[model samples]
Target: MSNHEVRMSEWVDRVLPSPTAALESTVAKLQREGQTVHRLGLGQPDFPTPDRAKQAAIQAIEDNFTGYTDTGGILSLRQAVCDSLRKEMNLSYEPDQIVVSAGGKQALFNAICTLCREGDEVLIPIPYWVSFPEQVKFAGGKPIFVPTLPEQGYKTTPETLAPYVNESTRILILNHPNNPSGAVYSTRELLELAAFCQRNNLWVISDEVYSTFVFTPEKFTSIAAFPGMKERTVVINAVSKSYSMTGWRIGYAAAPQAVAQAMLRLQSHTTSNPSSIAQKAALAAIVGPQNEMEPIHNEYLARRDYFVEAVRGLQGLECLVPDGAFYVWVDASYWCGRKLLGRMIHSSDDLAAALLQEAGVAVMPGTGFGSPTHLRLSFAVSRSELESGIAAMEAILGLK
Candidate 1:
């Protein structure tokens, strides 16, 4: 090994590998060895990119629009983003205030880097997206976790987050239509939280990546829509989930001009700009008619209902029906600290491993998201795959 590799910074050394990626690799290896693995660990949509978006990319390539665009994104793409936000969410934003990136992941990292400094503290609700805490650490900020339990539907209230705020609290990250929990905050709840942030002079990073996947009657409201919040809120969203264009790698953030400029600077130094073809595809996605996207949302809703019902059949496992995202965060603590197949199952990690190795099913351990006793099961796969995975897990737990 080279001596240069041994002299890496402590931050790089202490950073742990993403549990989601680790589980994905394990499943890939299992499949390589000819083991049939039903993967419910990663939350990727199993749908192809929309035909219109694919056509747009093809046209862009044919038109020779392959060169690098502006770091903040091409003007047409930003305008499309603004128009989509207005038409769909009734939220108003200017194209100049948007910063398009490789994906919603990069948009979030840019927000963290631009807003937080060393020793600054960011308030994140527990059972968060696995990337949040790690992103904060990468930005040289401390992540203060506020636990949100299954009883509360895994949604944190203003009360729950209040105590975590202090003089050093610079940002609060909220992933509504949340990743693992699928918790979508109500308008009233969001208003209350927005008021608190406005009073504290704290920045709000509202991640609405799953905004369009909401299944409830209550409408999804953006924090940026709250009065006085536009100046302080960085709204991150993408066409990845809404248009089933995950592989296109397109996402953007809408924020105040100053914040947007800061992110642009950071992005210029790092990624420069998102893929030109992907940006064109995203433009097509945002500008296209909405009826084409309905079937995807309906499919996810059916899968959510099916998985929640199946989980309910398991005696010890409890899951809340998520309103937006295609995940069922189940409390599998009943099996924690118990013996399973002659090995001590002490945490969700152990359960996940046993499920993959012993049952040929893959699920994400909640400890990666700061909830050690829970497990996240993605219903994004086919109904048959979901059924098989759940049945295998039930047999492993002796529930069937």
Candidate 2:
């Protein structure tokens, strides 16, 4: 290194921090100045870690279980994840097929970096998790996007995806009970996609972190569960969303043995292993809880039911009826070119800024998620927060 060397932006430097994190920081700044803030920027579920899980971590510390385990993870915890997947989703994975990482984000990164290379193109559905394309870009792979239709619940069909596939296509990233837009693919629909992938020899990376939170009649279908599909799919999951243990930083991917081994090698050099105490907590969360899911699901479903109806009932606002996960995708395209919130608004970003500035409500703009006409609002907070945020929105936008 030399003093003459200047900082530069390569693909490594191309990634931007999430707009959600930026909005959250702004909201914190405003609140520090004594403004009333209704926080709705992050997809954080407001539930405490289960009693048994918390106690397990405490007990782990008391018992001096702080030493590192296998870089892949403790054998027992990996086995626990395998058992849970088999029992709940009927998806089977041997211990060798799993690579535990810091979080689902890292798991996806490890998987992508392992599988994709220069000139490879991965198919990403639009309104994706903000990090998907960035991860692909960092891996030296091109991201070919296929847009999901709004009227179709934001789920892509094989017909819509056919145009995006080519000889360079290598992987198709699927996020069920999706981030930003809560669309869950049906098993039959996934089977069709599976057939298409099989014909094209395209590998699948399924992010099922929100696997447990389907609302109403929507069912969760892991793409790997499709017949003969496990060999081509890397199933990524975490306890952060379902078990409300975001800070635990534990996530794992179940892939074909070769793919798992590659990610395992990557993890060895980079993260080495996730936190041991977090693994203990995650194991407890995995094998201990049988009750909390239902109540939390009920609360989220109710919030979705009320929030969608309220959002759609408003004269100018439009929102999709979310099938799973805890977000409502509000279409703010109509507000373009209108003057409100002390400025001329032209896109979702403007509307988001306006809402936060005028109404003291922090909602995420959809630009980072690849949709400039929408906003992603999370209902993962308490019911009261939802009400307050919605009230602020209505008052400012005159939605009433």
Could you tell me the TM-score of candidate 2? 0.96
User: Which stretches in model 1 have alpha-carbon errors above 4 Å?
Assistant: 2-5
Q: Tens-digit lDDT track for model 2 on 314-365?
A: 5467887888889988888888888886699889899888888888888888
Tens digits of per-residue lDDT for model 1, 9-122: 877754678888888888888899999999988878898888889999999999999999999899999998888889877778888899999999999989998999999999
Model 2 residue 41 lDDT score:
73
What is the number of backbone collisions in each predicted candidate, taken in the order shown?
A: 0, 0
Candidate 1, residue 362: Cα displacement in angstroms equals 0.5
lDDT scores of the candidates, listed in order: 0.89, 0.88
- The Cα RMSD of model 1 versus the native structure comes to 1.5
Which pairs clash inside model 2?
A: none
> Judged by TM-score, which candidate is best?
1
